[model samples]
Target: MTTISCTYTGDLHCEATHTGSGATLSTDAPLDNEGKGEAFSPTDLLATSLATCMLTIMGITARSRDWSIEGASASVDKLMSSDGPRRIETLRVTLQLPEALDDDQRALLQRVAEQCPVKRSIVPLINAEIHWA
Candidate 1:
């Protein structure tokens, strides 16, 4: 298990440190949620994780097959519910892949991304839309 330490820096900001990696990050309250919108809020990180996880897994798959999927990136758009108990309603992801991917390769990569551990794990919790480009 990993332990994170966070200290409120006042004015709707918090400094978070990752003990394992000696990395530090800052979080700001989302604009819609209140407080001055600045850095990424914690929920933003969650949405980002899902998208990055899919990309990472797909990269690993390509590496294993000796395929170079360079110039590929994933874009994630998160929508939050406006009602009480505010929470993320959907995460729309679009992956831009290199031109090297053919029909079969595209299908395989799509399957891999959708079946990635993080994607499957969050299936019961969030609505994720994955698109290939």
Candidate 2:
């Protein structure tokens, strides 16, 4: 397993370091939560993680099949719950696939995107709506 190290900075901000590559990223609270919102909030990262993971997995699957998945894109919309802990209740993702794919390849890529590791990991907790075109 890979390891990620995080250091909490002040004012709802923090830095995360990827141990393998020594690359780092900064995170801050969202604008609604009172921080500067200059960077990605934790919740925003969570949403982004899902979208990126799906795309990456699909790319790998396409490559393995000798298919080119270039120009494939994904969009994410996160919904926050109101009554409870203000947590993310749903993530709606729309993937615009390259028009060059055949119907079978398109269906295969869609399945791969939805079955990625992060999707499985967050299943039953976050409602994921996946749209492919």
Give one clash count per candidate, in the order shown.
0, 0
Task: Check candidate 1 and list the clashing pairs.
Answer: none
- Backbone steric clashes in candidate 1, count: 0
Judge candidate 1 against the unseen true structure and give its global Cα lDDT, from 0 to 1.
Answer: 0.87
Q: What local lDDT does model 1 show for residue 121?
A: 79
Per-residue accuracy of model 1 over 4-88 as CA lDDT, tens digit each: 9999999899999999998999999998778677999978888888888988888999999988888889999998887778888
In model 1, the runs with Cα more than 4 Å from the true position are: none
Q: Which ten residues in a row have the lowest lDDT in candidate 2?
A: 78-87
Q: Give each prediction's root-mean-square deviation over alpha carbons.
A: 1.6, 1.0
Models 1 onward score TM values of: 0.89, 0.95
Quote model 1's TM-score.
Answer: 0.89
Indicate the residue-level lDDT of 22 in model 1. Answer: 84
Native-vs-model 2 lDDT?
0.91
